[model samples]
Target chain A: MNNNETTAASKASKPTHEHTHDHEHSHLDETELRVRALKSLLSEKGYLDPEALNVLIDTYQHQVGPQNGARVVARAWTDSTFKQWLLEDASAAIASLGFTGRQGEHMVVVENTSDVHNMVVCTLCSCYPWPVLGLPPSWYKSAPYRARAVSDPVGVLAEFGITLPTGKSISVWDSTAEVRYLVLPEQPANTEHLSEQQLGELVTRNSMIGTGLPDPASAVSQ
Target chain B: MTNNSAKSNLTATADVLRELPDIPRRDNEPVFDEPWQAEVFALSLSLHEQGVFTWTEWAHTLSSTIKEAQRDGDPDLGNTYYLHWLSALEQLIIDKNLGDAAQLNKLHKAWDTAARNTAHGLPITLP
Candidate 1:
């Protein structure tokens, strides 16, 4: 074998740490260790197809994330008819916009009014609608979040930088195996002149998750 | 026709997934809480799609891994389901001659070092 081929084979076969002595003090979290171990082994064997992986990741990150849900929210915010339809039948309304499949086959849209604020959680497991929301954030799946959301919705919201009105009653929805929820946050006061697209830009994943409120002032009008 | 069929499709998929462990798949949507969890899930699916392993084999291995964990005092809480999944994937890959333990252990250590040096929220680029 040629020198280059020898080097390549050895590089693939050898442990990377043996070549270096700099990591004397570092430690890995158990989950991180397992994930890396599998990923590396898969790559070494050519089983880790980067392109396929990217396609899956990009699909969630771009094509089927909060942005899709943002469009739904924006449409509902600007058009009363659409809003009514969404409230009445969210699955059909969302699917009509070409956002349907998998975790999003069933959906429920709950509106936040002046009197009642809505929050969502999955006490048993994180059951979120992936079609519109992509994936649930790590915090949503945490033990503290699952337990505390039911016991203290207001306090949990406060930790997420949300402070609802003192009089507004908080209604927490525990997402389960049968139903998924999407919160329709109240539109901010100054966004009346903004177009539907512009309004959609103002809606964030957290706001839709009911852990945050939209920052309309930051959504530059075009 | 499409709308009615779409609703039926939901029932179809939901019914099948209802039997899967760790997933409350009746009427509930699947929620992947972490990026790594999604990545691992996609890896398994892609592997299956490529005909590397049959669905039956994948399900059997995964269920056994979870069962083993339960035997070892794992609480069977929903959170650790994916951890067991990763374990099963590793074992299956090794058994199938797709990879070896020595290489995986090396990579694991390398990743630990690299991750330690990287700042929070930034992606870990293995060296």
Candidate 2:
């Protein structure tokens, strides 16, 4: 092999630690280490090889990520009975729409009644219900989210551009072994007669995550 | 998946496991009728295998629990946390012991298949 080719090959064959030495003393936390190891395994196994990376990227773009959280939104908007059922047992209720556990399986749907509003957090670890929702976004699992969601949930929601009314009591649900929760937000005003599909289109993932209210106009714009 | 590739991956993983710190044994443990602890132990290993966490991280986490327990005057090592995770999985696999094992094996095989397919520029679909 030529000198350049030899150098490239040598680089390719080098141990991971040798290349990672710069970050060795960086006090890599458990989460970081886990992410690194996962990436390393993926890369080494060619699951993250260059050509595979492209396909993976495409898959991520086309196949993965959140589907429209519209049905839940629509039910809240029009069908009061369906909304009640959703609040009672979200997993079974959502399954009716064929959206039962795609990613987040362990789910408990909480209602935002006139007196109380509900929010969710996986404080101990990111034990999300992936059966309904897809894999959690990076932000959901971040340390800031885990810490802040419990201590100052209102403030965190504010940061996400969501604000509750003064009289509304926000109840933060800590997802544990028995259940994972989704926030069944109140129906937004306007578009009362909109079709189920249209209402479903309006239910953004953010609303389900208790970060935002549904916006039919926004869905229409999209 | 090629046998060589699968073998190499297993070797790499085993090498990592070999480097892992020993899990300290506990004494006068709660004598449960079920093999709950073993199941939790297996789940932690499975999670580690699935790349949810690394050996070093798990080791450190367990170590911290041990340290905290020692400080709190609780003599028991923090193996219970892992034991709990395993028990959860075990309970999940109840009445389907063979099925659970098969599922684990399937996951391993899928990982290998994905790895091979990824090498060939094909997307690996996770089961």
Candidate 3:
């Protein structure tokens, strides 16, 4: 491709890929530098303890995320007794799994059954269960999704490529700061032999948020 | 401010968070995409703890910063959430007389110098 010369004298400049890569590399470095300076200022001022900051960052960076919620879903799918507990006292049931946190203090697990589908939205702001879901995706926080999810959940689910059974009702739960709702996505069919761990692998972050569903067993086995 | 008081008041900031204008968050903590995002989060909380500005002022600063960004055509697609947060923190510091633009500018320059002198793989100590 280099053999074909450009008419605008652009060949004199280095290849575009290399030029752009350097630009991005420096851009990242600039952001890194800014962070380092900010850290130095806070450290020098003695306002923030370095250890505490690391703990806070690590909590979100490593620990809290959708996988924890996946485990809860898997447990409920296989154990009817635990499922009853989860639906009734989600915070305690979830805490039993060692996913306890203030962000998940008052959780309510809404089951997705054959008769109905569930979705959650915070109409006023982004109130999400972080301990279970990590951060809300951009669309979840966007005004359109927040507004439309409540007004037209069926349409919103369609937008997400979900086509519910013709008569399956859709229910939208408006989340609040005091109570976060987690959807226990319907267990996929034909997975009777799969273990709980295997079932968890079928779950995606969106499934817990009710924006998506668990991958079908056959699709996941691939 | 004493260390003991700061520790006691950390949870209190969570309540103050409720007063801020619409912002994306998970749990009570602000949602962050990068380490710097979390850094800004902790920095603001720390500043609040140290009495750099009251939580009411923090709320006002963040709300106004967000409004300004919206007015300036920030599409509010959620990617630039932290940039507005950083702006709010800086604005509060300057407005409250805790720091000024000149000091922040110098901090950035010093960091740039430190970063330039450091080897590619090494940690850049502040200049």
- Best candidate (score: lDDT): 1
Candidate 2 lDDT over residue span A1-222, tens digit each: 356534544676565545433322223333323233333443444333444444433443344334534556566557878877777777777778676542333556777777776667665545555545544554554445554565566656766777776676667776643467777777767656667776677777767777667765764564
Model 1 spans > 4 angstroms off:
A1-54, A219-222, B1-38, B44-127
Estimate, for each residue in A1-222, the C-alpha lDDT of model 3 and write its tens digit. 232333323544766655433322222266666666566655666665777777766777667778899999999999999999999999999999988754323788989999877888766555678778876776776656675566556556666778877777777777765678899998998876788988888888878878789989444564
Residue runs of model 2 more than 4 Å from their true location after superposition:
A1-65, A102-106, A219-222, B1-127
All candidates: DockQ: 0.14, 0.03, 0.12
| Docking level for model 3 | incorrect
In CAPRI terms, model 2 is classed as incorrect
**In candidate 3, residue B53 scores what lDDT?**
72
lDDT of 3 at A207: 86
Give interface RMSD, every candidate, in order. Answer: 11.8, 21.2, 12.5
lDDT of 3 by residue, B42-76 (tens): 67756766667765566567657766887798766
Which tens-of-lDDT digit does each residue in B12-108 have in candidate 1?
3544443332311121334565778778877876787777776557756776786687679865655776787788888888878787888788888
Tens digits of lDDT, candidate 1, A1-222: 356544644665565744333232244687878887787777776788978987876777557778888999999999999999999999999899998854223688889999877788766555677778877765665556665566656556766777776677777776754567899999998789988989998898888878888876676544
Ranking by lDDT: 1, 3, 2
- By DockQ, the best candidate is 1
RMSD each, Å:
12.6, 17.6, 11.2
Q: iRMS of candidate 2, one decimal?
A: 21.2
> Fraction of true contacts reproduced, model 3?
0.17
Number of the candidate with higher TM-score, 1 or 3: 3
